[model samples]
Target: MWLNGLNLMDLLVKKLFSYPGRDFKSGRDTFAPFCKLDAKLNHPHSAYRTIHIGGTNGKGSVATKVAASLMREGHRVGLYTSPHIFDFRERIQINGQLISHEAVHRHLSHIFEEDTESLSFFSLLTAMAFLYFREERVDWAVIEVGLGGLYDATNVICPSACAITSIGWDHMEVLGNTLEEIARNKGAIAKSGVPFVAGPSAAPFFPQAIHVQRHNPYDLENQEIARAVLSTIGVHNPKGLKEKPPCRFEWRGDVLFDTAHNPEGFLRLLEALEYHFPGQKFYFAVAFSKGKDFQSCLDLIRPHAQGIFALRGDHEKLVKPEELNLPIEETLPEVRPLVVCGSFYIMNLKPKKGRETLGDWESDDGILSIQKRGE
Candidate 1:
């Protein structure tokens, strides 16, 4: 079967990274070619109502909750997020199920046939999601912006409603150095007549936006944004939708796993840790990808940690543990309240046998293991 063909999948990955697309650099016109591709695909993105979420943090959590809540309300929901922890298929899901391997092969085959020589990995995936959602006849699709909303490939879809979770200094080189600049870029997703909801920093930019009050418990703030977005479409009762996307305060035994790669994310993680495990200290196992403010993140969380374990993962962009200038430990203790965090690459590494597994289990061997099992 096509799903069993490893060579085909390898070829797809190669083609995905071959284009000279902007990895980090941003321009408003950067995604114009992808917009053309979507048009060629017969505008599948227009076939369903969508919710577009953009922010420095909490966007993924808000998107997940919004999709799950809609699904609970008896809507066929399509969810699209970025930087999958293990499988590429995790980026596209319908009602919490990953897109099947056969479906990926079919969509990628079609994309290649359309001359996707200039499309970046994210652009290709976004187009594939539009096609999949339309063909599947979904009632709603929740899309999280991969980067700044203005130039993100997913911006091609005119969403039914829009939200900005929170504004912070991230991707500063591309989004700009100041909070106001970042807010402007993320707030660009707002449409004239569309209902918009935003956190405090971004609320001023959208005059018509309903401001979601920031709360002490970070998840509450995210829930407020999701609730507001759902209210726009008459979806009430968003409580008890407990679909936890991997690596966001996911727990196994005593260890917690989080993809807190930036300063803002780490601050939130620290708050969660303090709330959940009051007066308890954790041993933090952390790593960061390139272009992240790792030092600031570390400094903020250091006070709450008993010790720090520096992790070196397979991804090329990961900052080596030695480079951080912290005293690095070689292995984790058999039983300790640990927090595995920073880059998703660190979470992708195999945990020691004694460590409890939580959420999605990422293989140390790489994509082949998860792809073969079709997880």
Candidate 2:
């Protein structure tokens, strides 16, 4: 654990989560506290060039693709995303490498030493990523907005380029009830005179954006947005454009994993599935966070799924299987092409090592624990 049984990384995570406004779910009064914290840290985000991306969906994919393409172009790139699947360190990366545990301890420990009592979990993490990127001297950093843009912690930087991948019904409580309102919040990332690119759906909100035409198979649209975003940063033709952020239509054996927590995202994902595996009905395992329109999400899946298993996750915000009012399975059926979607937290379920089989999904101490390799 530690020299005296104190693991610094664990301590940091605990401390961060203990904050009053640890996440968007907790509700934030204002972004002032985050800005104050950033100022106190001497504004580390200002040290390097950044590309800020904000939207309801496809943002993570676009951000990851942009970072990967920049890396291929021989640039030292730093990528900051959110809601990590397995490890928290996945949120911060430099050239596709996760930030070292020691580095997280070093930066976050120092940040905690500051007067950060009012900062949220996302704010602290963003500051730490900015500090890490600055010290490491990355050529460019691709920053994804954790929520809506106007008041998001990552909105502190005036980036070299900005993009809004797509605007859909999500976080409507924090953002707004209408698409125009949501678009406005996400489009706020665009700075005056800075190069901006956006998908067609969100382009109307931002007058400055160079609109990209819509592409079927949602991932292709993400790729096009990434390409247009890269062109703004002087990268015309970069490689690795096909690489996706974790958990977006990711496949392990026959199980398909996706982080399509909202109705719009689920529609896109299902459409992609229809295109890829036409006329095939698949089993589904799904759960969603507290604030989401879970019913709408479920409605979209019901028609396409052969069978559906309601799941719960370790996170406090996740809806329990019983709450979903759907059949719960302790061990998934030996069904091929099981489409696991709804939330990123479902990714914690993994096949056991050696046996290489999906078996025995258990709930212990509020953790929807699934036994993995060597555990």
Candidate 3:
């Protein structure tokens, strides 16, 4: 569909992004507009039970795993994530299936009919997800926080269970400078009667919530957090997450792709790589956004990487690879095992050929389209 010489999706994107940046213009009432919009829609989020997941890292994985676990219990599950790698629909899914273009168009068109000028891009999408999930009659919706928890747009919902996977240093500019400050901000999603779960690292911040102990491999710790969240909601002995989320230490052939953009995430990724591939040093291709502590990430990857290839993409937020004083590469190395890690935008540097299709797990659109629009 075309609207005034623009693809319908493009038109919608423009409208949604008009309110740029994470904060609303009137900072006094951050979530008031979202709450009013939800009330007007008869509070669609209340139509289904929700589990809110928040953290600096691993919240997406935890949300996916929690949704997958709920599915194992014979429930129709809706998973809402953020920062889509390919298509916007990837951020909203039901039973591992991306929301259809028709559904996005329908819900967004309806949403645009209202006074939505005050909403942020994430808030609009979160509203769309609530409406879609309600109409689809989902048994449960796993909502992932787009940013800090307290004032985040997704915090409008009163969830049955809330979990924060880990507390890290990313988003310090908005969340806080210290780990405790960050954890408190993310932990604010915990309501009086709602069950709250925290990973081993985030446990100290929320002594009232159920605390998950650390596991050896980083992946195991995430799985443990998911399992604990499920148990609180009466889904005991549920079958765990079958597969990892897209771009979370995902491997296509001998090439590994991970979106570990922050220092804490980098530490975990490197530790996992060492544990999984002992005595094997792999080549690295890396890029990062401007605000991230890329030096810390690079320092972590240096010892484990046999060779490093700094890559730059067209995204406005990405730091120039050459600025790091490393060898910049137009193409990834043809080594036996090459690891590509950093910002989500770096995925643009990946070749389409020889790439492993997500096999119905992802939308068919290319990353170039989203990146071109600076999404």
Tell me each candidate's TM-score.
0.90, 0.90, 0.90
Residues 1-375, model 2: lDDT tens digits: 334324657877788768644456543554787888888889988888999988889998889889889988889999999878766777888887778767888898889888887677778888889999998999999999988988888998989999998888998887888999888888878899999898977877776689999887888898899999999878898785787865677766677778999998999999988988888889998888877899998899888989888875677778777988998755444566688888887776764344353333222322222222110
Cα distance off (Å), candidate 1, residue 213? 0.9
TM-score of 1: 0.90
The stretch of ten residues in a row with the least summed lDDT in candidate 3 is 366-375
Q: Among all windows of ten consecutive residues in candidate 2, which has the lowest summed lDDT?
A: 366-375
- Summed over model 1, clashes come to 0
Model 1, range 304-371, lDDT digits (tens) per residue? 98888787676787887899887665544444778988887776665576564643454342221111
lDDT against the true structure, each candidate: 0.79, 0.81, 0.81
Q: Write the per-residue lDDT of candidate 3 for residues 1-375, one digit (tens) a residue.
A: 336523786677777767655672343265888888888888999999999999888998889888888987889999899888666778898887778777887888899988887777888899999999999999999999988888888888999999989898988877778988888788888999899998988988889989999875677788889989999999878675544577777766667878899988998888888788777898998888888898889898888888888886787878988888898876665665788888888764555456543223343542111110000
Pairs that collide in candidate 1 are none
Q: List where candidate 1 sits over 4 angstroms from the true fold.
A: 1-6, 17-22, 26-29, 329-335, 358-375
Candidate 3 global Cα RMSD: 4.8
